[model samples]
Target: MSDTDDLVEIEQLLARYAVSMTRGDVDRVLAVFTPDGAYSAFGDTYPLDEFPALISAAPKGLFLVGTPVIELAEDGATAAGTQPLCFVEHAQHGMRIGYYNDTYVRTPDGWRLRTRAMTFIRRSGDHDSGRPHAFTRS
Candidate 1:
């Protein structure tokens, strides 16, 4: 595929991830990641399998508005991107803001996320988050 084609595909992949997460569609979210994918954020490491459980714990009626900026590799086999996330929760907690740095790989299944490191930019409520740990490379 051409570079432009790959970039477009990468953007779609990133947007799908944001929408899936916003809707709490765990299966769809998992589909984006590699089976052995790692989520490194706030100095903690989590497996792709554990994400569903974690996200499920979030308060109900929460929505995330994400804007993603994608960068595709020359080989089209890898990609990297950043997405700023803004959350709207119906509960008293109000809004939350965060950023995600992601890495992706193109497999027979199409494009899948290899890693996602999320960083909290700001939040309406006081939340506890540690410093960023490992950085991601496409």
Candidate 2:
């Protein structure tokens, strides 16, 4: 694949990662990562296998509504980007906002996440309020 093609594939892989996480699809989320993939957020870092509980406990109906800015290296080895996550409160339609900085790598199996550092810029309503919610990811 050309560099552009590799970039596109990496973006898609990152998008899938976001979707899987937002939808609380732990298995699929983990599949988007390399064997030693790492996720760090809120001063906490853990391996892919140790992240299911965190993903599962996240709010449902979550969505990522925005285009990601992706950057690819010439060798098609490392691709990184920041996805401005528009955190829409699922139930309330548009009640919250946030973003995540994501990074990926092109592996033999395709593109997989190497790291995902989430920064909750601003938020409203408890993400895990146990109340209804709606949202998507990109």
Candidate 3:
């Protein structure tokens, strides 16, 4: 695929991720990642197999993903990006603002997330305490 095509596909992939998460479809969300992909948030790492349980245990929310800054690799097989996000939890009546740092790789199926690390910058509402506390990995 050409550079333009790659960019469009990558953007669509990111959008799908947000939509899937908002819809609470763990399977669909996982589809955006590679088999060995991982998501790190609050300093904890979740592998693909464990991700669904994590999502299921979390409160449902509205996920808004901002435009990502995608950089294609020179070899055309890998890419990386970062995107700001706002998450509003219905149960908690609060919102968290953060950014996701992502690594992408071209696979036989398509471009997939190799890893995603999220850093929360702010929070407010029922959970208010100024900024949210970061979780430490055990």
The alpha-carbon lDDT assigned to residue 32 of candidate 1 equals 78
lDDT tens digits, residues 2-78, model 2? 87787678767767876876777788889988888887664566677777866655556666656777888776688
Looking at model 3, how many pairs of residues clash?
A: 0
> For residues 8-62, what per-residue lDDT tens digits would candidate 1 score against the true structure?
7777777787678777788887887888897766678788877776567555555
RMSD of each: 5.6, 6.7, 4.3
TM-score of 1: 0.78
Best by the lDDT measure? 3
lDDT of 2 at 79: 76
**lDDT of every predicted structure (CA atoms):** 0.73, 0.69, 0.83
Q: What is the lDDT of residue 50 in candidate 1?
A: 74
In model 1, what is the error at residue 127, expressed in angstroms?
Answer: 13
Estimated TM-score for each candidate: 0.78, 0.76, 0.86
lDDT of 2: 0.69
lDDT (10s digit) by residue, model 3, range 1-138: 998899888889999999999999888999999999998875567788878877876668899998999999999999999988898998876887778989999999899999998877743323221223343223
Residue 126 in model 3: lDDT: 36
